[model samples]
Target: MKHALLGASKAAQWINCPPSARLQESVPEDPSEYAEEGTVAHALAEIKLRRRLTLCDSKQRKALDAEYEKIKTNPFYGPEMEQAVQEYVELVEIRVMAAKARSSDAVVLLEEHLDYSDWVEEGFGTGDVVLIADGVLEVIDLKYGKGVPVSAYNNPQPRLYGLGAWAGYNYLYSIDEVYMTIIQPRLDSVSTDIMPIADLLEWAESVVKPAAVLAFAGEGDYCAGDHCRWCKVKGNCRARADENMKALAYEFKDPALMDLEEIGSILFITEQLKVWAKDVEDYASGQAMKGNPIPQWKLVEGRSNRSISDKDAAIAALRATELGTDKFLKPEELLGIGELEKRLGKKEFAALLGTWIVKPPGKPTLAPETDTRPAMNSVENDFANTDMED
Candidate 1:
């Protein structure tokens, strides 16, 4: 279990690490079999959609058969491929129906690698779907994550894919506007957003360039926290050591012992530690700036509060339910000390109270014992009498 956890951590690390760093650190393992499965599912969906658009008799079964044949020999496909293929076929059918109902055109690109640059220095990605209808292009990406639906807005990967699609189709034919969509069949939802060419270029310049630089330099810092629990190098990272020490100290030590004096001392030292850590991080950043190959580190925050527009409506609806307001008793409505005594009788209530009010564990109450003065030794008097006798 430990080894598996470690392997998973390394996999996650590799994903965020820059390509150059990945090349340096042997060949980072490809994403898990599940990721491959998702790709197969996406590929099948694209193939099915393409057949439906091109063929006059585009029966669902025919499309499914073609998809199955395409994936049969692939080493990536496993036992779960059958189920994934079934889901993909159903999703494609649903999408086709929706497009037909809306009187919209749907086109799919099968294994189409859209290259933006002639030299292909950096700009290129395979687009799964490039839908052209009503004089607008919609780039749709398929995701298989069961969590929250993937959003295309502000997502670099999808945007890059969109750029590739734009370059490919525009160079071939012509396009005025482009819309990006991320469809998560597992979640049964599609998130759509739009980006202008100019905006996308700006994103590439401002975001992608910097990320690429850091990744190329292999200067990503060791960010140790809750995330370190899943980091590949957690066992060896100094930051992890510091974190573990702090955690253990907090857990075992008495809270009362962490008085103002101790807290103040820690706070003072913490500032110094922060400065030193930042200095190291800045050194790495400098190396990245110098074009030294390094892994990439992105600053990601914890989950933020979600905005709920219908909060009041939700509360009102909950109150209307049988297991809501009627089932809950107000805190103030509960019996008080005096009332309890009256109901249960003084003796019973006293006994209950004795059990209820818990006493804390006793503390050491030892006092110092002292002697007022030293006593003369009996041996000295015995020696004086013995000398007289001699």
Candidate 2:
């Protein structure tokens, strides 16, 4: 799909740093396998959604099945994608059922083009599922990636989608409220944020519109923060580099002299600073590859490992050296539980190997408070005193 210049999905970045939208305009987009996989996943989800929600005739069913078979042939598609997309479709079905309960005449729409051009300069986004009822309009988006668990609460993208949804459908329905939901089946995440139509409109007027005006014109101050993660210019953005560099401007005291509070603040800064370092490195490497070498640095082959080019011939020569089969090959081992589960599926694998498998405690690791997992019990909770369950 061709995205708008002020696309809703990138609202967070442009809203915060209005100038970034145009700054990234000329930088080519990097092809991502994860994104390709997500596209395939959404295609599968849509087919299932149409089949289950719409009353399909026999011919329609065959068509949908054929569509699904074609999707299965994609390299990124598999049983895992099939199951994840099916779960996402089921979640949408549940929401549709609830919408129908609210209004018997409720209408469900799939892949609807929602335009919020009133608040933004040609801003638009696709709502994966839109349910229009008497008093409410719901926009549900399917997040096919499992990278970062997405929440709809006060989230800019879905809120923009909500704005767009209400904009497109307000005349048809007496919508006083909008519900924006993001379903990430692979990550087992479902989040919904409810906003009254008036409040949503107010946000658009106050927060989104002003920033969008500047963004569309490619004017406004450059700012940087977490939203830089997906920016095409993140690797070379001076604003981001300056922001991360400010962490080093902190006056250093002896580690023993710095209080815990101060140390904790530094931890937060270093986390983002690390990502900045990697981005700079990657961008520089790419430049060097294109013969635009960075100052004082040139590309050089680093390392290699030798391996047999003809495994069969090598094995034949090895056998001629009086090495018997028993000497050459090791005993076969069962596949790991994760691989088995992927191959045989969850229920079947569980039924066959449930008794034989036991999960030990997972190693403890530092994570942000926003992680949904329960906190370790505090016997000092210094993390050293806790055992984490898988």
Candidate 3:
């Protein structure tokens, strides 16, 4: 009953691992707080943008306001969440303005449902923001996740959204170029990829359509890559295991014995192996919990930390018994410098405490030459030179 495996958000995964679309059906789609938080953030962004544009009807405005209020009441709502949504709103506003500037007749569409069934079978998705001008179309997506920095270059999600937007608006607008932008405000990453209308359509027809057909029919390769991270079947995926195990076949006794490419291959395989091992462990644990224990394996209680069940009452009782507060709880102390900086704005805190600050050179460490940090002086040579100078 699990659906949305072929959703635009997951186009990259199914397009690459075609079999994953069907395989995902067997696994339960576990709810994620991060996802829920993102939903709330998106709702907030929609409300703010709609209000700014004065595009909302009275009823729609009231409903959105209610939804916004309800979401703000969630425990996850905080200053950071508000700020991130605001950042997305500002970026959309800027892009909309830029689009209109190019041509007075330019139109900005919000949360528009786009049908891409022209190339993909019954394919459709909503573009967060779509800007159509004289000869250009811009599809803007707001990515609420901060864990990974998403890029628009060859990124399937934005591309799919772009295609959907184009399919819906191409008839009205003489759109020659398509611009896809992924705005990840949390990570401060905004990446855009521009493609000609002809090329974008060609790629969709040649690449996406075929892949989607195979994926929907549960017939295609299970090519594994970074896209496998969020796949439901990843833990028990045989193809993933087989692919990772290919590294073990290489019997290089030591890393130094391998060439540049071999070493790189080993490194990539090692990382995949780590993921595979973790997946196996999680799958086993889950099975055991469901009374379907693995051979010679049984679930055991994990170590737990002690806690004060009734801290306030216990503390009161202790105080009544003439026990000092220090016996149970430490005296209140001033916040650490780091905490103070957070309490006061960073700039104000720095200005106040700047004179007292001292920064020591960090210890030398090994890193690839491509690292942005400057390499430290050689320890032995630096000490020797210091001694001679002294």
Candidate 4:
């Protein structure tokens, strides 16, 4: 399926930074194996749900074999992949049962195609599963990626799905409440946000509609923030560069002269500046790999560790030389403390090893006073404590 220019997955980015929608048009999307795997996972989940609901048409049934075969071609398809899809399917089944129990007339929609073009031009998306009851509508979205823990609270993608679902089923059902659920089984996270229809529509009119208009028209400023994570133009976004540059251009002043507010603002921008710097470096490296060299920069072989050309052959040669096993092999060591903690489970590990655990004081670092972690004791305080101990 083709992705819309302003897809729901990117709603957070374009909604906040409207110009990004048009800016991304010129930059081609970077293809990733991860994305391919995610698509396969979604397809498998859709197949499972459709089979359970028996919602597929004859044409869809005919295409199922090809779709299943296509999934097999994906390197990511395996027992683990099937297990994860099964977990998501089970959750959807539970939701479906609950919704039907509330109202026998309730309907469950699988991979439902929805259009919200009335609110935003060309705005449409597919909902993984949508449940509509007498006065409630639920949109359940499965997130296959575990890099970011997605939450439904104030999440734009799921909310947009909810909006699309309500638009499609509003005439049939009196949906007073809309529920958006994100199932991220890899992270063991299931987040749901309940929104009143009145509030969602109000927000759409006030914030989303206005932004969508500007974005579609290509007439808005590019404001950079966390939302730039997946924007196609992020590699060379001038607005992002300008924002990061401003952080670097801060004038030097005496530490005593800086006010608390000024220091706090600097701290906030510094972390963003660090991330932007890394993004720039990574983008340049990727371009360099395609024979587009950055000025005064060229790739060089990175440091590598030594390894046997063929482990078995090397072992055979060592044995032929009459080398003892003890001479050729290293002694096994206990697993790392972190690995043990994970294996034993958090509570069990903590209970068993609590007495042995000692967290050394972290090195003093600068941060905004507003940071939640308590400030490290002052040098004077540390010395005072030492003196008292003496």
Steric collisions counted per model: 9, 0, 0, 0
Candidate 4 per-residue lDDT over residues 292-388, each given as its tens digit: 9999999999999998889999888888887798899779987877667545644566688889889998889987667669878889999999999
Which one wins by TM-score: 2 or 4?
2
The runs of at least 3 residues in candidate 3 whose Cα sits more than 4 Å from the true structure, single-residue gaps closed, are 1-5, 57-60, 253-265, 333-390
Error at 54, model 3, angstroms: 3.4
Per-residue accuracy of model 2 over 199-315 as CA lDDT, tens digit each? 999999999999999999999999998889889988899988888888789887776688977877888788888899999999999989988989998899989999989989987
- Using lDDT as the yardstick, the better of models 1 and 4 is 4
- Each prediction's TM-score versus the true structure: 0.45, 0.91, 0.85, 0.80
- Candidate ranking under TM-score, highest first, comes to 2, 3, 4, 1
Q: lDDT tens digits, residues 222-287, model 1?
A: 344433333434333565557545643533357656776566556555654564455456546545
lDDT of each: 0.55, 0.87, 0.83, 0.85
Among all candidates shown, the one with the greatest lDDT: 2
Candidate 4 ranges with C-alpha deviation above 4 Å: 53-74, 78-80, 251-265, 330-390
Candidate 3: what lDDT? Answer: 0.83
lDDT of 2 at 126: 87
Off by over 4 Å in 2: 253-257, 345-357, 368-390
For residue 163, model 2's alpha carbon misses the true position, in angstroms, by: 1.3
Model 4, C-alpha of 368: deviation from truth (Å): 7.5
| Cα error, candidate 4, residue 125 (Å) | 1.0
Instruction: Write the number of the candidate with greater TM-score, choosing between 2 and 3.
Output: 2
Itemize residue pairs with steric clashes in candidate 4.
none
Report the C-alpha displacement of residue 107, candidate 3, in angstroms: 1.4
